[model samples]
Target: MGTKPKTRFGVIFEGAKRELFSVRELDNGDLSIFFKAPPFYDFLDGRSEKTLEHRYSFHRSLNSTPPAITLMRTVALEGGQIIRTSQLRWRAGESFSTMVFARACPTLRPEHYIMKERPKDTVILLYPIDIGRTTLFYHVVVTDTSLDPVIFRRSGLWVTSETFGHFKLVVLSGFFLILPFHRGFVSHAMTSKMRVDGQEIGADLPPIDLGNVSPERLLIDIGRMTTLLAEGLAERHISYIREQRYAERFVTETRQLLSLRPVPTPPDLPRR
Candidate 1:
């Protein structure tokens, strides 16, 4: 009998190299196109109420331009065969529109959560690219409300050994979430650093400099009771042991201090 190979999540970035060139070309083209248009004006004829809104429509257009890269998903089998499975495309010039939608209103549903959809948004265009034997596609999806939760909580932490630039962490807090994004580059090595409540702690590091003392020292300074509270939230067995040890040490020290009484000189036995 053969054993099944383990599968893991991975991200493959497309057209990353050509990103700068594509953006520059798109910006120049948009600028030239808008420069030919005349300025807007308002009229007070009373027949119609039209006002001039000269608000850099061209700049918005340029900012909304999509990247030339394409994104896709792949699956690999145990025997070392790679299979291209899913096609994930990027939407062009939909950034601003989506931002507007999210700012306006937001909603959450189980089914629509995974797939990106915008209720009050429109699509601009779809661009296709050829990656060797694979054909990739990019579509612009826009919305007036936030599309979806950036982080997948069930998956926990997503780590990669590639480059630090490609790493991303999406933290969800309350009704809003934050997505911290970075780009991958071949010239630099990937580094991972972690800090708990502004204090740096954890193994596997290029040693994140949190500008504060080490986590152990911080906990010690805060006292044993507070340290235990933090350890409870961490929910890690190792952390519990660490807290216990710290408490034990603290108790021992306190007892030692209490036991030490001022040594009596015995008054030199009344000068003997």
Candidate 2:
């Protein structure tokens, strides 16, 4: 009888030359490395299939030990999908997920969570704060409370990567749950403004090139801001539905929206 191959760990990434590479452990504990040229698809133009070629092989070895790879599942927006794979779940720890719903009041179920499929052009990243709560960062605002009845505004994080080309990596930054009406002697409001060291930023400013900034320094800034935001939310004592409900609803909706779409691809290099 033939014996099954032992499992091992490895890493995978998309190369600059439009190739997919993998470094995985062999049955005898040795490592194997190789690359594959993905079928041509105009990902930027969205004319072809969006299927990703490379994926984490963890799902294939369900009976393995120590889990060949650890992964986190995220919603489809912000470059996440309901599909299971390593690359999609690669940054699971760093990634957060949430849903925005129109809340009629603090003690009532949200009418329904808001949904947006094409958030790449404006949304940067999404940060999970808590169950049913998230933070979203925006470069542009196509739909706001003024035009539509969006009670909560989820914050998303934005980052740059070589594989994605001009397309920014969007992640969960935080969540903003809006109450339909003032609930008590206190209230809060959302703004399209930001400040660095007390210097206010204009809403019409262009997106910053992340390449020129130190990731550590930027993270420090984001952390401080996120802390402040959380503290402020706590102070407000805004009561709303918590996680279990939100999570269940989120998962169900995400699955329903899953479809074979073009795998998000990198855009042309940023102009020098």
Top lDDT prediction, candidate number: 2
Residue-level lDDT of model 1, residues 169-237, one tens digit each, is 111111111111111111101123223223434456353221222323422322333233333333432
Per-prediction count of colliding residue pairs? 10, 32
lDDT of each: 0.22, 0.26
RMSD of 2: 22.2
The reply for model 1, stretches above 4 Å from the true place, is 1-69, 92-272
Model 2 per-residue lDDT tens digits across residues 1-272: 44322211111111111111223333543222221212222333575433333222212223444222222121122233232212111121122211111111221122212222232212211211111222222111111112211111222232222112111111222223422122211111122233323344445443322122233443454444555555454445433334577546645644543532422323431111
RMSD of each: 28.6, 22.2
lDDT of the structure predicted as candidate 2: 0.26
Identify the runs in model 2 with alpha carbons over 4 angstroms from their true place. 1-109, 116-163, 172-211, 238-272
Number of colliding residue pairs in model 2: 32
* Candidate 1 lDDT score at position 250: 44
